[model samples]
Target: MAFLGVALLGLLAGAAVMYVLYRPRFEELRRQAEAEAQRLRESAQAQSRELLVQAQAEALRVRNEAEADIKQARQALLKQEERIQQLEERLARSQEKVDRKLDDLERRERGISQRERQIERLHREAEELKHSQQAELERIAGLTTDEAREIVLKRVEATARDDAARLMRQIEQEAKDEAEKRAKKIISIAIQRLASEYVAELTVTTVPLPSEELKGRIIGREGRNIRAFEQITGVDIIVDDTPEAVTLSCHDPVRREVARLALTKLLKDGRIHPARIEEVVEKTRQEIETIMREEGERVVYEAGVQGLHPDLIRILGRLKYRTSYGQNVLQHSLECALLAGAMASELGANVQVAKTAALLHDIGKAVDHEVQGPHALIGADIARRLGRSPAIVHAIAAHHFEEEPQTVEAFIVAAADAMSGGRPGARRETLDLYIKRLEALETVATSFPGVQRAFAIQAGREVRVMVQPDAVDDLGSITLARNISRKIEESLQYPGQIRVTVIRETRAVDYAR
Candidate 1:
């Protein structure tokens, strides 16, 4: 029991010592924590004051900027109101000017109306005075108004008839003179400018041989080579006494050309056999065809014409081998084209159409052997088939008067053809045929009734018929001329044109007292 009491007292004493030591340390820690909390509170208060000051300054700046914006908007509105006021004032001034113009127009209209009424009154008074004067004149003339008018009209009729007749004669004379002068001038100019070579192509082509020995070679064994050449070329080979020359006679110019070429080549090669003749003839034919095409192109280029069909050009080239009355058809065509183009330019016609028509005028002669028609009509058909224009086709057809010339270009082409054909040395006719034509023309003219005498002048171009004055009056003479013309046209196949003239004159014989 004693030990237990002493142990308990020792434990209480240890506990009291521990409590005293820990209590001082706790007090020191608490004082430190309170001082830290106070310092943090003071820092927070200072930061809050600074934030409040920044906010106040920002609010003041924003208020000032907003007020400035409102002031600018008010100023802009005031300026817009001033502009509106100025526009309104301008509109008012314009309105005033318009009103003044309207008032002035109204005054002018009123004045015009008054003047019109005065003019009408004056017109009525003048009409009344004219009627009174007419009545007075009728009384003075001792005739009724209608009778006096009839007399005056009769006098006027006589005067007018004489004047009109005189004027008609003068106008007719002037027109005839002017037309003749112009025609002569154009024809002269055309002839003067165009100085083409006159070509006289014949149906016979003469081939000159190297020697008379060649003629015998050409006429081979049993004349078999000559027979073969003729059979192949459709040409007649005539070996005459003429030295070193053989004649190739064929109506077809192309065959004649081919025969001439073949003969010349055969003579050159010195191999005149039947087989060789046939071969050489064919090669010559192809060469001639090439030559024809080249000639056609040459003429087309020389004429400055374009867009001709290949087939048409080939046919035109064939004209180079053709001859009409001893005139080379191709040269004639070129000459006519040049003449027609010149006349067309002077007359304001289509120059290209005129030239093309003239160039192709004798195209039918190329194929006339195959086709059965007049050359002009056949050429027109060919042109139509080749897609030539209607104007060109018409000109081709009308060149020979087979068809009536409708356009100026057609007439120009016809005139050019006449000029080319009628010029001296352009063509030739046999002397016998020429005489027969002139005689036929005179006979036809004399055949008409009341024809006293007839003479063919101007190289048979014109027939002058003198009629008996008693049998044929002026009107009958005109009828006789027309009849003679119609008869000549129906019966005669003449070149160019023929003019028929009838003359009638009456003589009243009375001795002067």
Candidate 2:
């Protein structure tokens, strides 16, 4: 059994020997395979790293390209915006030019259309007139148009005189009505605003004496007092013409007043000597100077004159001894100042300035007889000399209408002067017109075409013409009166115009009253 176990062990030992020899070869092969497997893993890791680097580089390049493209696009957009703005401005300018052209075209078209219509209307009217003339020519003696027109002209000319007279009368009446209405409004307004007396002065004045024997005292021994009185007063002392009175005849009112005072004093003192007359005259002169000062002071108080120069005050005093158109110069100036002040107050003018100018308006009258210039210029020079303002001097100069009024105050002074001086019967003319005034006025009224009878009424101040009612109506009476007035104004010269009145009476007398 031992021998058989030994043979099996030897066979197993031989097989183990063969396995150990092949184990070396197998180990070598395993080692080589492990080495190849490790190398392949390393190569794969390196290739993955290179591929990651290439992808990172490509992403960076793409990012830079996108930024450059965005910048170029912004530039292109800015250029397009500028081009659009330029196009819009050009369009706006073109629209403005078109609007201007359209406005001009519209105005031209309107004018052209009006001219075309006028031309067409005139052509149509001319055609109608030509046709009418042709028909008229044929009807009138079968003559040509020119011959017919000439005959018609001759016939029209024959009646033209009457037509012309009627047309002239109508035109004159229309113009006169308009002018009279305006004049009446002005005069009425002036008269209503001004308050003055209606007293009119006469050329002759009567001085009354206490007794008839006083007249003998007025005439000194050898009639020297009467002669001296006439020479000093420049008046005709009609002592013997009337009974128990004496008539003062002088054109100057100031001279007449002086003579009256002198005669009155001589009568009161019962003096019949020339030396006593001379002494009375000196006293009368002083009294007149005092009266003149009082008159000037009264006017200043009434006119509210302040801040006047001493020279101006003296000139104001001189105005008392002057006369204008037989009216007292101081009274006239006072009335003018009142009127001017009232008007200035109404018109919002400088009231104090206007009153001062008006009060001194007639200052030139005090020296006009001695001076050689117009009253207006002389008064202005006086005012300027008295330290008056240029405006006041201008107003004083323009009061007489000798110079044009540049201000409202000047116009007011002129208007007031006219209102006071232009009243009817305000002044009397010289040269003893008493010779034939009433007779001449009556004769002038009867010279009209339809005047039947004339009577001088209102103490020869107004003449009334009685016209036949059937022959002359109220309008014709007025026309006849105007004709008579024109003749009287031209032919017969008299003092303080004689008013001509025409009376056309249509009455049925029953004597019931």
Q: What is the lDDT of residue 509 in candidate 1?
A: 89
Residue range 411-483, candidate 2, lDDT tens digits: 8777767766656655554545553777788888887777789998875778989998988865566567768
Candidates' C-alpha lDDT = 0.89, 0.78
Query: Which residue segments of model 2 deviate by more than 4 Å?
Result: 1-70, 73-219, 222-241, 245-256, 317-326, 423-513
Cα-based lDDT at residue 290, candidate 2: 77
TM-score of each: 0.61, 0.51
Worst 10 residues of 1 by lDDT: 473-482
Tally clashing residue pairs in candidate 1. Answer: 0
lDDT of 1 by residue, 1-513 (tens): 999999999999999989897998989899999999999999999999999999999999999999999999999999999999999999999999999999999999999999999999999999999999988987787798788789999999978766766676578569979998999888888777776667677655889888898888888878998899999999999999999999888878888888888888888899889899889988999999999999999999887788999999999999988888888899889888999988888888899999999999999999998889999999999999999999999999999889999999999998898888877677889999899989999989888778999999999989999999998765555556768988998998776778888988787889988
Off by over 4 Å in 1: 1-172, 209-213, 240-245, 469-493, 496-513
Give all candidate RMSDs, comma-separated: 12.2, 21.9
